[model samples]
Target chain A: MPNRQITIAELPTDTLEPRHFQLTETDMPKPGEGEVLLRVILMSIDAANRSWMRGATYRDAVKAGDGMPTYAICEVMESNSPRIAKGDIVAAEATWADYTVTKAHKVQKMPKVEPLSHLMSVYGIAGKTAFHGLMSIGNPLPGETVLVSAAAGSVGGYVGQIAKALGCRVVGIAGGAEKCKWVEDELGFDACVDYREGNLSKKLAAACPNGVDIYFDNVGGKILESALNFMNERGRVVCCGAISQYDTDTPTGPRNLPGVVVVKRLRMEGFIVMDFAHDDAKCVRAMQHWVSTGQIKVFEDIVDGLENAPKALIGLLAGDNKGKRLVRVGADPK
Target chain B: MPNRQITIAELPTDTLEPRHFQLTETDMPKPGEGEVLLRVILMSIDAANRSWMRGATYRDAVKAGDGMPTYAICEVMESNSPRIAKGDIVAAEATWADYTVTKAHKVQKMPKVEPLSHLMSVYGIAGKTAFHGLMSIGNPLPGETVLVSAAAGSVGGYVGQIAKALGCRVVGIAGGAEKCKWVEDELGFDACVDYREGNLSKKLAAACPNGVDIYFDNVGGKILESALNFMNERGRVVCCGAISQYDTDTPTGPRNLPGVVVVKRLRMEGFIVMDFAHDDAKCVRAMQHWVSTGQIKVFEDIVDGLENAPKALIGLLAGDNKGKRLVRVGADPK
Candidate 1:
């Protein structure tokens, strides 16, 4: 059988054009002694992909020309390790490819949960980023106001649900009415402010009358400014992502920041998820418990083909995806 | 004896003209119950006086025309309260006036650990401001590197000493050779960087090779930017005053801040000593202990007479004062 693989051919420019991705069919290699051949089932699409394309974010941190970064749902196609036998469902850091092989340590055993796609999503890096941002940086207490920007998306959805479950008054800020409704009614956010609506600052203030205590900032332009204005004294702002500013050639600084932090005594910290990679098991266990108890909801916006990965990623950045944007590559052998 | 009172007859614009202050000789009234007549000795001349003259800083948070705010060393001329008696030396809030009547509660019993002038100098607001900025906001831990701007001044002098006593590697930024040598030798700073000599960024980086863990910022602008650049991960910057920008009509913000805080997770907080009035006793007691043990040295630049108050304050803003700048309105009776 012919194996398939993906390669980083050309880097994307300022704008991530469709031509940036060069798809070529190549023969996949056999598994080493401790390796497992994974038949890629689903691949996640994230704003972080834009950084991978531009060759900026991970250039110095991680090696260059490392096969395009991705997280994928897979099945053990073949394995030398007894831990993951053929046909065992798993999740691994693969690529925008159909089949790939990695060491057993790299392959995580996806737990049997309510929704299988969640293993590649709400229980994935995106989810963990939000979880850590909330738990460690946020330190949200019961009855406190928890404000989340990009709140209808993957990490935002989980963040809202978790804060709600933790007894916080969760408020979300998204681009449209549909996203706002989903955040309020589906994820059970106490209120959702549509940032696209005129007078976002006033609307956000009205939505969070008591003022924001914990701000999970994903969009970091005007939304950040609005949240800063609404923050209560000694508020915590977790800078998990700056999706709004990520695409620009040059990022804009927070103008009102000095006054904001000074007047309110606020704490705003930016962090990478891998900083808390040591606490993976803790995050997974807590998320699993929440899933089993039905206290949290996981949503995946699945696109059915590996060929559509680039478009899916583009759509994800455009706020077109409703939840954890997933590109279905192949069938899960399980 | 005729009682004389001083009033802000006119507001100052660009400079302190004679009309800005009005002296009126009034009849000396009998001391009311629980009040004492304070024969003003030493008065604090601070840039905060400039703000007090403006009647506001950022907003109308601190209104102007509050009878010219000053912290003074005074002799109790007469007292009706049992706690305070005539001819006792004390520290109280007196204006730019020669004699002012204040309640016994408004006065603190002078500690004999230091000279009456030194106590009214370092142990007063200027010194307490430094202590609070270092311990509370800057939070310099043992063996950490602390960078203090305006090192030879009242606040910065105490900041270097406190940080040194706490086992920190202290670096000072001052204008001239005299100030720099005084900071390094007398204040016990590990090194002193002459900010007036050359490129502040390069100098600061060289001075703090290990990176700055805490920055006690009195001189804002370029010093702030330099301090921000050399900040280690999780560094804390305490903005007690922005003397570097105090003279300007509109203060300039540090442009390099976003890059600094985002990369190092640095926290910059502004504080006023009055905000900690609830725990003022704790601060005073600790300072008193430090003073008595010779662990901390107090510096005073005393200008004799009430008439020289304006010139002394102007000299303070011009960076003339060697230590805590005070105006001796009258001699200490004790």
Candidate 2:
């Protein structure tokens, strides 16, 4: 019966378990009026899934018997909704479940591309968030410099690529030489500094000689502090995520932010991609164009089976994923 | 013959020297090719004049044998430049000297006004700074809420009054009940909160129920912190001066500043009025109009004699000045 739907009955801290989800055998979720039944194909594993449990914005996660928080690409097997017909491939937000019944409008039609897999990578929510952070908040102009942290990660890779496409000199901060090289050579970033080399501040300063015009901060902590010293006057800092402090009991305080904002007259803003979902069509169109033009690239670190989802999430938190971490829940569509 | 102007080597920090300036006759100074000799009639005493001695902005205040950085109503007694002639009354930056020779353009022809003294008060640098901070950076649109700290002081008074004239609901934060009443009743501010009331945050929140849209921050300590919690989304904080932090060895950091920027997406920019000296005429005309129409009021806490300059400056630091603190060097010319 649809491989027995699994759901989280209780929250977990520091570790996750299969008990977080209850496997129940039942009739595959039927598409009610104005709804479509979606079969989960691919689901992304993120470090922020833990934080989603406590955040006010993710109150839906706290609802009893709700599935895990996940973004997945699915195939509409049945539809009573006018917007979607049978066999329509789509992307939707659902939990750790084999099948989900959702509103038709919530399912975005997957775009066609060379690597059909990229529909869930750079053209997906992670990639779109990075794009928006650079374009909307960072507002990088041609000839200006853009610095991105966690450069080898999916979001960081997209940030660097998008900034490069906009004619900005892009610098990336990552953990290792391999990741740094991949970000520079593969992702097309101008330069990548390895934060693992130590002396992060010194290296960052040397890399950004003209000073950073835009900083798309993903791994905020000491890296954000180091980047602040290199920001030029009237710089824009986009705070997309703070992965470095996500698991800590007490969030790290940025000591130098006050002086940075005052002396440089900088603008720093935080945003969530869900807030931009109202214009999903516009985002999808822009991302699709960039993907087709080869101006953007996507990397997927895929793991087989839903049983590996927790492990993939743990690996993501440990910085093991070179790009977007996805757990294949079912067979790929022909 | 005139005094080449000598004064106490340096005024004591704690007390005023009764014999601050001695107008002993030395020799009549000759005007150079681009210089004019001026007979001082009136001079302004500003809070910054105190820090001028320690080389704050105006490099090392007129050494023992030099003139002070005082703006005065003067008569051009002698000139070697074609731009100015003898017996022309002008406004010049002549220090505590009885008569001095300076560059011709440094002496601006005194504008005709009913109370000629008002020109030196309202059309002065402090007024211009207040205007620039309020209109340029603050940009207080009509029906917006504006809050000014140290609202009874020189710059703060203008900030409140100008905000009111711009159709903003203005709130003032001052130390005492008297000053608070003065800012609200006399300056036409919508509300005033006495910070000395112990619960400044509560009082401010109660007064500015709509939330502060623009904040003209003159005192930048606890008041700035309190205002941060009350800022509306997209609030603009004009940092004209941080008087509260100027003297302290270690300035207390505004605890709520980072959250203020993130939550409200606030813009806080620091500025110096000297940056707008090229467009001083526009500000002068605007201020004169506001004064002539009775839409603006000038508050001058006249401390008589140049000798009381030290006390007046100290009073300024202690938030003792009710409005613009001026040293009446000579009789006010009607």
Candidate 3:
């Protein structure tokens, strides 16, 4: 069988476009010793993918002609190691491809669910990221206000819902009026501000009358700047992602940082979801409870076909998707 | 006795000069009920005093025609409140005046020490600030690389020495070759980089080859910008003061902030010494031990007379003082 893969055509110096990636087909290969062949099922599309191309961050830098890295759910088609059996569903560091080959130890075996896409949404990166960044970094107290940017996006939608589940006042900042309404009405946030509308500081101040105690920042730049102005004394700013500045070469930062950080005695910290991988079982248990109770709503925006992966990411960067965005590459195991 | 006072003739829109203040003779303040009449023995000049004129910070904002506020060592003349007694030495919120009248309850009584200025330098605000910020915020571990800015100045001098006493590798960034040399030879830092010489990022990288684990920031702006580039993953940035931005109208912030902060997983926290006031005795105990063991060296730059108070502050902000800068307003009790 032929394996279709999306590869980076050229490194983006400024804004990334669909043309930056090209789809190519190659012959499928057999698994080597201690390795397993994976049929890529669902591939997670995140802002961090765009950031990887910018340069090396927490992960290795993506270069021209490199397969786009992704966090994906795959089925063990052929296993050479005794640790994994054929037909076992696992999660691993994958690429925007129809199939992937990795060491058996590198893949994490996942439990079966009614809907396999749930593994790519609530039980996967988006839900876990929101849980960890909000709980571990933000450390939200009951009744405290949590102000999150990119409210309608994958991790952010979960962040607000999780903050609400923890009995905190959750407010969101999304790009437009439609996203803001969905964030407030569907996600059940206490308030949602449209960043596209001017006077964010005033609007945020009005929405958060008590001031923000925890700011879960996904989109940095002007939103982060405005959030800094509304933070209460000794507040925590969870620096999850800087999607606003990720697509550009000329990225402007907050002009009042470290100064406002000093005056307010604020604690601004950052972390990757992988940092809390050891606590995954614990995170999953809590998330499962919230999901079952309906306190946490799961919304997976799935795009079909491997060919649309580039377009999905580009649209995601432009604030197109509403929830956990994933690209379905192949058929689910029946 | 006539009280000679320095009042802010006008608030500076940009750089503060001696001409912004005027020395005037006023009637000595009398003790009212629950108040004490204090003879200001010595006044501590700090960069934060200039920050106050810019706008409100941890303290109230200073306006035009207001007396320049100071942290001072004083001799109690008359006490209306039984909590404090006459002839007791105390530290309180005073001003650039020979006499001050404040609530007796607000004063902290001090133990008599020879050269009383030691109470203003090592055991006072400068020492406590360095202690609290380094120990509490920076959380320095032994054998860690600690990078401090404004190394020859009041708080920075003590910060480097304290970090040294804690068995950490301490590098300082100061202005001019003389100050840098003084910081290395006199203050005992591992290395001192003169920021004025240009190419701070290169020099800092060369100095801290192990990479900076904790950055004790004092003079924000470009120094902070350069320091962020050299911070190791999971580093801590102690935001003590921003003297560089305090004197200027147009203050530029670190352009890579919250981005570098995210990628590095750094914990950049800010604080006021008063936030740790409950642990003052503990801080003083540790500081006194360091001072007695010769691990911490104390330097007091005493500028004589109340008239020079404005000049002393201006010069201190301009990086003229080598250590804790003070203005002597009245004679110490015999």
Candidate 4:
């Protein structure tokens, strides 16, 4: 069978676009020793993917002609290792492709869930990222106010819902009025401010009257600056990602940093979800409980077909998707 | 006795100048109920003094025509409250004046050290600031690389020495070759980089080949940017003070903040010494031990007379002082 793959046509010097990616078809490869050949099911589309194209961050830098890296759920078509069965569903470092061949040890065997998309949403990177960044880094108290940016996006939507589940006053900052409304009404956030509307500092102040005790920052730049203005003394700024900066070459940072950080005695920390991989089992248990009890609502924005992966990422960068965005490459098992 | 006082003639819109202060003779302050009349012995000249004029920080904002506020070692003249006795040596919030009358309860009694300036330098705000910021915030481990800015200055000098005493590799960044030399030869830092020499990032990288484990930030701006680039994975940035930003209206922040902070998984925390006041006793015990064992060295730059207080501050901000800068206003008790 032919494997369709999306490769980087050229590195983006400024804002990322669909033109930066090129779709190519190649012959499917067989599994080598200690390796498994898998059919890519659902590929996670995140802002971090755009960041990887910028330069080396937590992971290796993506270069021109390189297959777009992604966290994907796949079904093993063939396995050379005794550790994995042929039909086993696993999550692994994948590319924007129809199939991938990777070492068996690198792939994580995933448990069967009713909605497979849940593994890409709530039970996967988005869910675990929101949980760890908020619970561990943010350290939100029961009555504390959590001000989260990119509220309508993947990790952010879950972050607000999780903060609400923890009995905190959750306020969200999304791009537009529609997203803001969805974040507040659907996600159960106490308030949602539209960053597209001017005077973010004043709006944030009005929304978070008690002041922000923890700022879960997903989209950095101006939003981070405005949030810093409303942060309470000794507040924690959970530096999750800077989606606002990832797409552009000329990224303006928060000008009030370190000065405001010093005056308010703020603790600004950053982490990758993989940093707490050891606690993934504990996280899944809690998330499962929250999901079953309906305390945490799962929102998945799934785009069909592997060909649309580039467009999905471009749209996601433009703040088009409402929740955890993913590209469904192949059919799910009956 | 006539009290010679230095008042802020006008607040500086940018860099502070000696002409911004006006010295005048005023009537000696008298002790009211629960108040004590203090003879100011030596007044601390800090970069934070200039920051106060910019706007309110941890302390109230210093306005035009207000007496320049200072932390000083004083001799109690008359005490209205039984909590403090006359003739006791104390550290209190005083000003650029020979006498100050403040609530007795606000004063902290001092021990009679051999060199009175030792109390101002090693055992006072400078020492405690270094201790609390590095030990608590930086959380320096032995054999770690600690990079401190303004190394020859008050707090930075102590910070480097304290880190050294804790068995860490300490590199300092100071302005000018003279200050950098003094920082290395006198203060005993592993290496001291001259920030004025341009290409700070390269210099810092060469100095800290193991990469910076903890960055003790004092002068925040370009130096902070340079330090951020050299920070190792999971490094800690101790946001002590932004003296660089304090003196100017158009203060530029580190452009690579939160981004570098995220990629490196760094923890950048800020603090005021008063936040750790409860543990001051414990810190003093540790510091005293370091001082007695010759693990910590004391360096004091005593600028004589109340008239020179303004000049001392201006010079200190301009990177003139090699250690803890102080202005002697009155004679110490015989």
TM-score of the B chain in model 4?
0.98
Query: Compared with the true structure, what per-residue lDDT tens digits does model 4 show for residues B163-245?
Result: 99989999999999988988999889999999899888888889999999999999888888889989999999999988888
Instruction: Write candidate 4's Cα lDDT for A52-150 as tens digits.
Output: 988888789999999999989999999999999999999999899999999999999998786788999999999999999999999988999999999
* Local distance difference test scores for all models: 0.76, 0.75, 0.91, 0.91
lDDT of 3 by residue, A197-295 (tens): 898988998999999999999888888988998999999999988898888887777767778888999999988888899988898999999999999
TM-score per model for chain B alone? 0.88, 0.86, 0.98, 0.98
Least well predicted 10-residue stretch by lDDT in candidate 4 chain B: B249-258
What DockQ results for candidate 2? Answer: 0.17
Kindly list the per-residue Cα lDDT of model 1 for residues B1-334, writing each as its tens digit.
Answer: 8765666776666555556676667777567999998887777888777655654343342232335667777788889999998878887877677778889988987765435776755667877788777888877789899888888888888888888878899999888888899888887889998877888888777888899888887877666766777877778878667675555555555555444454466666777776676776787788778878887887878887777776777777778778888777776554
Model 1 lDDT tens row, A1-334: 6655545555654556566665777777689999998888888888877755543343332233445668887878789998887878887888778888799987878766545677767788777987888998889899999999899887888888889889999999888898898888888899998888779988887888899999998877667877888888778888777677656666555545454565566777766777788998899889878978988877889998877887887777778777888888886543
Per-residue lDDT of model 2, residues B182-209, tens digit only = 8889998999999987988889888999
Docking class of predicted structure 3:
medium
DockQ of each: 0.25, 0.17, 0.73, 0.78
Poorly placed runs, candidate 4 (over 4 Å): none
Clashing pairs in 1: B41-B329, B55-B64
lDDT of 3 by residue, B1-334 (tens): 7888989999899889878999899888889999999999999999888989988877799998999899999999999999999899999999889999999889999999988999989998899999999999999999999999999988999999999998999999999999899899988999999899998888998999999999999988888988998999999999988888888887776767668888888898999988999999999999989989999999989999988998999999999999999999888888
Can you list the residue pairs that collide in candidate 3? none
iRMS per model, in Å, is 4.1, 4.8, 1.2, 1.1
Clash pairs, model 2 backbone:
A7-A21, A8-A20
The runs of at least 3 residues in candidate 3 whose Cα sits more than 4 Å from the true structure, single-residue gaps closed, are none
